[model samples]
Target: MLKSLLSDKPGARPLVEAIRACRWHLLAAAGFSALVNILYLAPTLYMMQVYDRVVPTGGIITLVLVTIVVFLALGTLAGLDVIRTRLLVRAGLRLDQQLAGRTLGRAMGSHETSARAGQVMREFDQVRSAIGGQGALAILDAPWTPIYLLFCFLLHPLLGLLTLVGALMLFGLAVLNERSTKSRLLKAHEASARAYAAQEQVSTRSEVVRALGMRRGLVARQLTARAEATGAQSEAQFTGGRYSGAIKFLRLMLQSLALGLGAYLAVQQQISAGAIIAASVLLSRAVQPIEQLVGAWPGLVQARAAWKSLTDLYEATGDQDEAHTLLPAPAGRLDLQEVSVRMSDGDTPQLKQVSFSLEPGQMLGVIGPSGSGKTTLARVVAGAYRPQLGAVRLDGSEYGQWDPERLARHIGYLPQDSVLFAGTVKDNISRFEGAADPAADQGAIDLRAVTAAKAAEVHDLIQSLPQGYDTPIGPGGRGLSAGQMQRVALARALYGSPRLLVLDEPNSHLDQDGETALMRALKRAAEAGAAIVIVAHRAGVLASADLLLVMNKGAVSRFGPRDQVLQALQGRGGPRIASVS
Candidate 1:
């Protein structure tokens, strides 16, 4: 199962590639570490000579010189060790930045279904932690271990053979552990994803939960998800730990055997005492790096899993075609012909052969009962989704042919939930990326845009705040009420001065007075020659529209001038239409 999860994600290559691209720096650090190990190994040989040869010769001066040389060698190795550490740390930081950039870039285009933004963020953090922690050491140690083993073999081939066998056995055990715990690791990943999703949802809808008196229910659900995740993690750790313990035991036995054999050979005079001592020292040095690699196995697995997850997300979202050449702004003429949208299940269609058109500067209000596909139709018109069987044309040009950014410049879309970022009201209004217009500039405030805000009736509310337009709204504008948020959204839409505006349930949460203000804003926007299309439920809002479109079962059941549609609806005993001011 872990293998399946890893294989399922093709997007992981970029992350892996990013790491591999920094191999030169890693190799340089590994070289320095290897040099330090060699210097440190010299002391053991010199000490053995002092005991076995120098004392027999009674060479007191030679002993003093050898001791000083060993200390110098030790100091040199210590300096090199510091250099290697610094280099690896620097390289790891670079990798972190690269990973963060790649992850965030992928998040920008990732599919909504995959919940990619959060996933990418988590993966990027994991990759960073892995590199900064044991990951760099593992890279250095894995390759350096063989070099040390070769040095041991040069000291004495027999002891080298024994050490090689032990290392091989330890490696085999680690591989077995990895394979056995693979499924557990995958389960843990899935559990973590579910837990994160549940937590995020609970956080986002905390207010709703409290209002509906479902706080206990939400808390219970969150706890269940967290528990499941914790359990899965525990199981994975237990399984991995069992195999790790066994491997460590086997390694310890092998090291002991190598030490015993070396000492025996030295006593028999088959190998020089200095050679035996060097072998023993090299063997000891090998143990820590070997153990480190073994210990790093779990992190490697997790990094792989994270890599795969990121890859899957990127693949799913990155396959979109490049945006075409930018097209000129449309005349606000839109037409949808034989449009149909089928859900992924391919059984129930959300929209079926729906068609409509609006003349330039016209105000069209779409009314429908719940589940009548009103929002779906608006999304199709706004170019959020492509229809399965038809086309959406704006000013005689197909939406797909126009550059997405350019199309956005012409069409303003406000979804049911107006997402606000962590910024002041003015920042949200001027989301456009460019130099400030000199004519609109007023210190930190854009006076021209602020005038639009006043027209939208949100200007007074903003000024009432402690910082006025500069007040830092927390994430998602949590500081603002729903009505205030709606007006802010409207002001943002108007700030773009878009040729066409598509709003879905713009005033759903507004009070009567706020709704009146919204109507006035819409009338002003229409008078400015901006084509406005709104999905509305209230008769008061619908009555003010120049045209009314009533949708039923994914198709337009009635559409005409407001008065005609209202008269027909009243005659049919449908909802009464209110007067338009």
Candidate 2:
């Protein structure tokens, strides 16, 4: 069953395998469901006994004993139902425990757009809820519907026929419900997801929106999106609700008709008065599972969609089950050979045939006009994106040869935005390493973090804060100025004296003092034998650079010793390179 649901792709099996791992528990739940359904017959049987045997004989003690027996059965049924629910909930927790880390890792590493990434995690939560909630209970009970019909048949052939007809009609209604709402619900879900993504963007960039007087316009746009989503959802619900009402009406009418038919049978000497109530009870039970299933169909649909989305995402990302080679620490030598990257649509390559090499202790400055792919090259060297062609190697081995986590320990990257996470200054500097408790492994963490801060020349500035190293930074480094955030980000990159440092416009937000600090930090890193790549729009930040690479139209225009490249450009009138320098 699991194999049929999931493809044989490397990463695609985990989600299904997680459910398969709980097969025993599911079977046990099914067993409990069977017992519960059997116990459900006790009420009808007790009523029949009261109406036919006890009332005719006036046997009070007999009635009391039967009541006690049914009560005991009811109590046991309740306990079993609780146990079944707990089993399902525990299975869901185990699924989460087994797959949450891997899911989060894939979501974070996804090359998909921001909106798609947000939807991926939401889909995970939906799958979890559907598997563990009342929807699962309905599914478990659905299989026992045939047993209920059998009991109705034992009561009378005519009553059994009525139940089968009603069951089939309800089944038809369920099919109609599915067909009516499935597509509409899917559209609503997508629209809602997009609206939520936009709202998140507004929250994360609230300052930009408010400062630029775009708040009202953005809010109005959000309102329109939300209204459209709500309208689509409402339409689906209305369709489902119409079917639900029809099914409910059919169930009530069927139960009533069974009673009337039973009374007629009694008049014709075919059944007892007790048989009338019992027939009605049996008919309701026979169709109950179908009704519950129909009611839970929306959740089931959502789970199905989530399952497919996760399966496709896992296939795309591949699994991390294969062991990576444990290579020695890199010595900062960097090489890019015939490297090129293109859009997935096979558009022109963003970085075409870009090749470069930097030995240990060498500092390379990358300068280019906007859209010249300098940033793309820096990302390639930083291992953030793998090129479609050729290779990026550190110390002589391809980046793919090393474990990603191990490689990350020896590389530092400060992107153009210089973003910081929510943590104390020391915590951010340490990359959130060590225990949360101050007395735990924080001593070593603090030592290394402090050293990095000093190297970035941000230690004195941090010391001037109200809590010094422990000062808390809000989301997006909200508590700090742009220059301060950049300095802190630089310190984070410098932590543990990473062998390869990639900085994209690190000095963009810096004042003269901050720039001086940045220059000193670069010089110190180069002196420590770290291979460095710095992308800059201004030449002043490249004073310590030993080599220069100039990019134009996604291709390298000049590459050589920094002085030689600058001299050559000067001879060419340097207009093309003016903004770059």
Candidate 3:
């Protein structure tokens, strides 16, 4: 255990590293607690002196002097306890600072449908709460158990023996508590994860669920999941509480039993009246830490489980954000050499051995039937989905070799289904630039956002809103039409005038005028020396393309200049003619 705690192996868990780094804090807190416990003996010794020395000698002056000095010692002890608690809180905050951002970043870069991606944050919260609070205090005080027992031994051998036996019994109960609740907590965690996942799915597809009258069924399913989780959690907590209650009972009874035993010893002239009370006091102090440990057991288990879960997730995802030397920003050159992507759920391959290349100022139109790998190709181009086989490169450097955030600045992507965050039109367009920074120059940010909106042809519609670019959108905010959402997403993709633009059916919800605006946007983007890839089934959307690619399943059926592919397809004019232009 000591080796594991001290070792900083290559793949050591982050939580372990946190504990290791806070070792000094833990030691300092324990040192202060030792002093407090020693001072705790002051009260017991004072009682011994009062009954055995003060009452017998009629020594009022001695009693007052002892009282004064013991109170001062206890006051210092309380102050030390306060400092110990503060140190633990600081350690917890430092641990949070170390892991929170990394966990959030990994979650953000992870797949949108990832179940564990969201769980890491909650797990970290559990760890932080457990570390800085009562659980840690109990652990810090636990080591003094043996020292308290030794004090009882000095008072009388029989009292010390009783304390040792009582401590063993209470420790046994604590072990049993762990044994009873460990599996239940694990089950509860799994059930809660399922419940959360079900609720997230229901929320994301709320429209369809409500429209189809499936809301009742979805809600019922979520409730059932939540019930199972809550039931398991309640059962485990009940078991832990039962054990803690038993430990408390044992601690109280042991002290009373010690007093009784010490009285018998006094009657036999083995000890004095002072020793009787001192024996009980010493036994209580010995049992105090064990009782506190029992109370803290459940929280400790939860933190341990959370640490294990986070470590497992980090290992499974392998999302090591390497900060290698920055390659120069990509120059709009993209190459795909026999790329293929396998579905995570063991579905059929989405794209198979599809290869293509694009240069600066080139615009490629991908026309295919539904599920013919068009959207997959667009995602690959935008670096949204890394292919399982082959490679994607920009400017002769592998995509993984570039810093993702920097690479993202040079890439623009509009998914098949448009998405809008809970923010203003300008915030969505500017990707929350000035909004995230309260001190940013808002006027300059608004001007830049408006320019992008005009480029996507959503500026006039936005200006018509109650607050123009600052108009709120999302749940409880101003609701935009489906076409408006698509246009705003388009404006977002075009915001930075990115060197590489991937639009997966950007005009899916657009009207005739919207389509015209989209054509102009594409033309302007291409003329500005940006490489654009569009996945569209609409023949009219293809008229502005400089190159054409057709997909008959997952394989490319045809690839050539726009006029050649269109002319050959026109000569044939088969079933695909309407979709491919």
Candidate 4:
């Protein structure tokens, strides 16, 4: 899963391009932060001088002017700091927006695992936060630290040594913290991912659990997983925080020791009082950046871990070797040449050396017993999965050669369990395409005509409530019966007027009247020159077909015109059935 998040680097281009995009704002913010730090440090050093020598020299007016200058400098620094912060924040927001746009666009088109997508999204958030928060401080303080250190070294070498030691110690502490917590951090992240997956599973299948009276069991399992994950995370965070606190306390103690030593040197007259005072001020300034570095250690570690996870996700499932563009409407002819599919676990093949062909405007009925791979065959034809050793072709051209988007335009597939989104019927039918009447485009299929065709055959028994086609359907079309939902799915597929239509178990929940209406619609579609494939177990639906294919153990056991196939099945003592009531 982690393998899918690893995207090919945009090379030096994206990095430099992103920087250039926000360069002006970054420069302004950095410049202002430097000015603020310099002004902030100058007043403290000057105050030490005034106390140690200026007042003693009796320069009252000069001292007053200098004090005023300090206040004005501080005010300017404070104002600039605010402006800089706002500017950097805006720049960060813009950068995040741009990166997120690119990421989302890639995500939509790439066939990555869901786990990998989640990891990518998590990493994106971490990067965004870093830029907006600690990242900004790191940028400002990192550059300023050297300049401030140089000033301290000039003022007093002893103070400079102390500041250097403190910075080193802080760095050592952060490194130690990272090393100790890295494993725990990774474990915590794994736990979180599991908990999220569990929660999603429970939410997505809530109805099934409730109906099966397993709600309590499902909830218990979810809560247990969540609690375990929470405990792991809390333990990791607590351990890291305790270690950080200890380091901070030790640093503070060393700071006090440094100040005391500097004061003692001044009293011995080994150093000027002004020098001691300035040294103390500089030591404080030096420790500030170190403190911030220590404080940001946890976030940095977590962000790195997230980034690694994202890279791993990308590596696992990012590559797609079969990158053919989908073709426009297939010639309404499909041929499966000795196609076979095996489970990823290397179990017995689900489909094996199955070969069949449907001519343009033909209707093929697929029939089989339970677990005989009828639905699987339908999905194969629909291009949901690639057959291991064979090929699916449209109009004698390999199906993979067609662009996915263009192929979708020509082929309409309805799964056994049709799902509907939460929206008005029109909205669900149009999906991302806005609700311009589906009937408007020249070649556009009319969804209403599809519905009318089904209704003419008497399939649409119940009119949609409240607003007809505009009525809002609950998620998954929960308010509708199974048969009603099936009809709606049929309407959607017909609305596209696709050249090739694949319907899996469309008659599963339909009553006699509904089945009649559906058969009429299928006949109408066939008459309109669309190739139709139906996967079914019922004889009524099968008898209406132009051809029948009987599947057994992943192979086509029998195939011919409907009458001949039925006659053969009857000769074997199969249930004698009628084609239509």
Candidate 5:
């Protein structure tokens, strides 16, 4: 069974490995469950002894001895139950430790929306909780239901038959409960997820919503989504509640019937009076697991759905450990050969057959009108997007050849959005890199970050902040002006003295001085042998461009020396070519 579960597939590997790590604990919990269930029979046996043997004979010593044994067994049973619960909880924690980082990493790095990321996280939590929750305990106890039924049979054939009928009824009710509530619960979950995503979206962009007078409208939409989700959930819960009440009523009725029928058998002299109590105890025990299972059915369903979702996501993302042997450091050289990218559902490629090369110390300017695939090209070059055709190489090594984290140190990309995370200025500039050792020299790390800030000419600006490099900034760099955020982001791109820099609209929010500082920083970076690609609309920003590539409708229309490309554009009466001079 273990061998069958431990699949060789990449997607299953993480979850399988997590389960393997916790196998011993799970096995121990199962073992404890067996011991605990066996001990549960102590009460039935004790009651039977007192009624059939001690009560009729009036032997006080016999009653005392039986009660002592039962007490010891019950105590042991309680201890084992505690151990079982702790073992399962440990297993759940271990599973989380194993997969949470990977899940969050995939969420952050993938192109999935924030809503999808949140949904995946909730799914992962569901699976983790199911491992240790009452649902798991109920599942473990379910198999031992037969133990009680066996005892019932040993007590009397008629009692065993009665218990079987009651068990089957409870089982039927559970099945009915599942059928009636499954779709409703599923719908509720999806609606809740959508509502959560909408709320998250609005919260993240609260500033925009308030400024645009969209607060009331967005809130109304969110409330509507929430109401629908609540309605579905309430209906599902109400249906489940009805079954729960019925199950409770049926269980009580069955126990009473067992007692009454036992009495009839005893009065007829068909079975001993002690057998009556034993039959009632056994019947209730037999159906107890079923009742608990029914109550925990929703959690089990969620867990099953979450497991499938996680597996699908893992499969879609492919292997996380794709790293090979560490290569030597990259030099400031980049090459793209016949690279192309197409949307999954689109017929037209976003970028088509584009090729380019840049040696150390060279700078390339990309100019294009809106929708010319400039951003896509920049992403492809930055190793953010893998081309479906051809390759992107840094220092003659394909992007795939290098570990992503290691390669990122050699490549700097300032995206069009220039979004900054909430962190200290130093941490932001340092890309959140930290020393593993608590006693490590944090000063050295900060020094390097400060140097990057200085390189980008943002050092003075940062120093002007309340705490200088230690100043905390909110998400999206809310503490800084737009130009300051861009400059700070530029410093981040310059950190580690990366071999290649890709800047998209780097000066979009900058004033004249900020633009001049940015241009100066780019020149210094180039002089220091960093190959750079700058995508921009401002021709002035491309003044020092060694080469110019003009893009037209996702294809390179012209690529040559800066002056030559400009002259061609001017001569052809193409989209107005602004002069750098």
Candidate 6:
């Protein structure tokens, strides 16, 4: 099963693999951090020198020189720190750039997976942000923490032991933070992704919600889901906060304890007063990495979970090769060989061993009652749903053997509720070519868009707009009615003289004139040698179908010439017209 879904393409490695390529940047950043840690010793030493040498000998010039040297070293260290930060940021960006396309491609296939997988892009973003966030910075500085402990050891053995015990305590707290928060963080992330998908569904059906007075109900549901996710996130943060606060408290107390111990040693003649201050500073530095780690633990957990999600997607998108077979243009010789497609639950097949055949210059109308698989059959015919059994063949070759992008070019599918994005009517009709590129292939794209509009018999209707073809018609700009959106979508389906056209409820919103225009377009397409399958309920459109397939309860009830099926249906007790599925 994994082999079938996962692409075997050479470039399809997980995003984590790309992250490994940035190790050099990480290494260089670590080297800079090491230097920074070395420079940190300057403050302790300068203080020690001032107390022991300058003050004791009354050497004012020595004190001034030591201060100047320490400031210069600190200034250089600050510059190196900035450069290292920039390097990490750029590395994160480069990692994101390398994997963004791959991640989006995986997301494009989300229609086949769980709703939560639809937000793979968000998961990728999380990983990218965490890579450059404070969590990663803390990890970089963590390794040098022991060096500070070693400095504390050189100050006095008792002080070193005291700081080590304290550092270990904070390290234990950091581990506790991860243990307490990791699972909640993962759950929160999943909940957030699902909430996003739910909100997306609500946005698409905003008109329906308002019309049915379901706004309050829908809003309540969305808020409830979001609140649950936010609650989980808050719990994780609260856990992290407790650990961070405890680590800070322990570090402060340990610093004071190190001072008290050092002062005791000084009185015993084992160490001087200057050594006490140095010991305190070194002890704080020793535990600082553990404190930062505790603070950034939640982000680290989120990033780990995101990595797993993204990696799973990359694996599932399996080796769908783009090197499509250079087969000759099909003659629209379509065949469904005992095809079957199980619904989402896999308990019952929506299309059960359905079979059909069509040749060029023919139009097949599929009619059925609601829940009779009319839409499912249309989707299978258009290659949107891969059959669970048998084959969808074009010109004697299975469509599964061809790259989907190439197969789509020769095919046009207008679903039950055709949708348009944020663009002009012309752009929507040309499938965004008019909007995507106005400077290159300008003339050719315009000609294709106009030709498609003319074929759909809506050219004059479009010309009536203020800017004609260029008039914006999506969500933000002037919106078109349902009939207009369907006609424009029909024009999109009619583009490029496709060899195969599959439409579901083409006239679901059209008026009588629009229906007439659709008939003319169907006839023209058939005359041009395109095989068309139109799912419709209206008998008027069926008048032009060369063949008819009547479906009932997920099976083909009858298949023959249009007249034969119509004659049979006329003799029945009730006319089995198509219903929206």
Scored by lDDT, the top model is: 5
What is the Å distance of residue 529 in model 6 from its true position? 1.0
Sorted on TM-score, highest at the top, how do the candidates line up? Answer: 2, 5, 6, 3, 1, 4
TM-score of 3: 0.90
Write the residue-wise lDDT of candidate 3 on 1-581 in tens digits: 34543324434355466677777877888888888888889888888888889999999999999899888988998899899999888888888887787777666675434565556788878888887889788887888889989998888888889999999999999899889999998888878877887787678778888799998888788889899999999999999889988998998899889989999999999988998898988888888877887777767777777777666655543545456567776679988898888768757888888888889899899987787888888888788888888889888887887777778878989998887888888888888878557899888878878888998988899889999987899842238888988898899899877889999988889999999999999899889999989888777778777888887667787888988887887777622645443
Residues 48-166, model 2: lDDT tens digits? 99999999999999999999999999999999999999888777777788778788877776544446567677888888787778889988888888988998888788999999999
Q: Considering lDDT, where higher is better, how would the candidates rank from best to worst?
A: 5, 2, 6, 3, 1, 4
**Top-TM-score candidate index:** 2
Better of 1 and 2 by TM-score: 2
What are the RMSDs of all candidates, in order? 4.0, 2.3, 3.2, 4.7, 2.5, 3.7
TM-score of each: 0.86, 0.95, 0.90, 0.82, 0.93, 0.92
Q: Candidate 1 on 1-581: residue-level lDDT in tens? A: 22453333354655556666667767788799778767867777786778677877999888988888988998898899888887777777777766676667557644244533455677656656666567567666666677778877877788878778777777787778778878787777777877887788678777888999999988898889888878887887888788778877877776677668878998888777666656766776666566776677667667777767776666664434354766766778888888998765447787888888887778999987777789989888877776778988988888778866578777777778877777777887765332324565454347646876887888888899889988878767789887788888777777657778899998887899888888898888778787889998876776568888888877788888988887888889764446554
lDDT string for model 5 (1-581, tens) is 34643446786677788888888889899999999999999998898899999989999999999999999999999999999999999999998999998887775566333355567888889988999999889888889998899888887789989999999999999999999999888888778878887787788888899899998999899989999999998898999999999999999999999999999999999888889988998899889988998888777776776676677667656545664778888778899999999876578888999998999999999999999999999998988887889989998998888877889899989999888989898888988886324575788778889999999999999999999998999988888888889999999999989999999999999999999999999999999999999999998889999999988889998898998989888888876756886
Per-residue error at 145 for model 4, in Å? 3.1
For residue 551, model 1's alpha carbon misses the true position, in angstroms, by: 3.4
- Candidate 3 off by > 4 Å: 1-24, 111-113, 204-208, 313-320, 435-447, 475-478, 548-581
> Between the candidate structures 2 and 4, which one is better when assessed by TM-score?
2
How far off is model 5, as Cα RMSD? 2.5
Model 6 C-alpha lDDT per residue in residues 159-238, reported as the tens digit of each score = 88998899888888888888898899988988888899899888877888999999999999999999999999999888
TM-score of 1: 0.86
Q: Model 6 — TM-score against the truth? A: 0.92
> What's the C-alpha lDDT at position 262 in model 3?
92
CA displacement after TM-score superposition, residue 131 of candidate 2 (Å): 1.9
How high a TM-score does candidate 4 get? 0.82
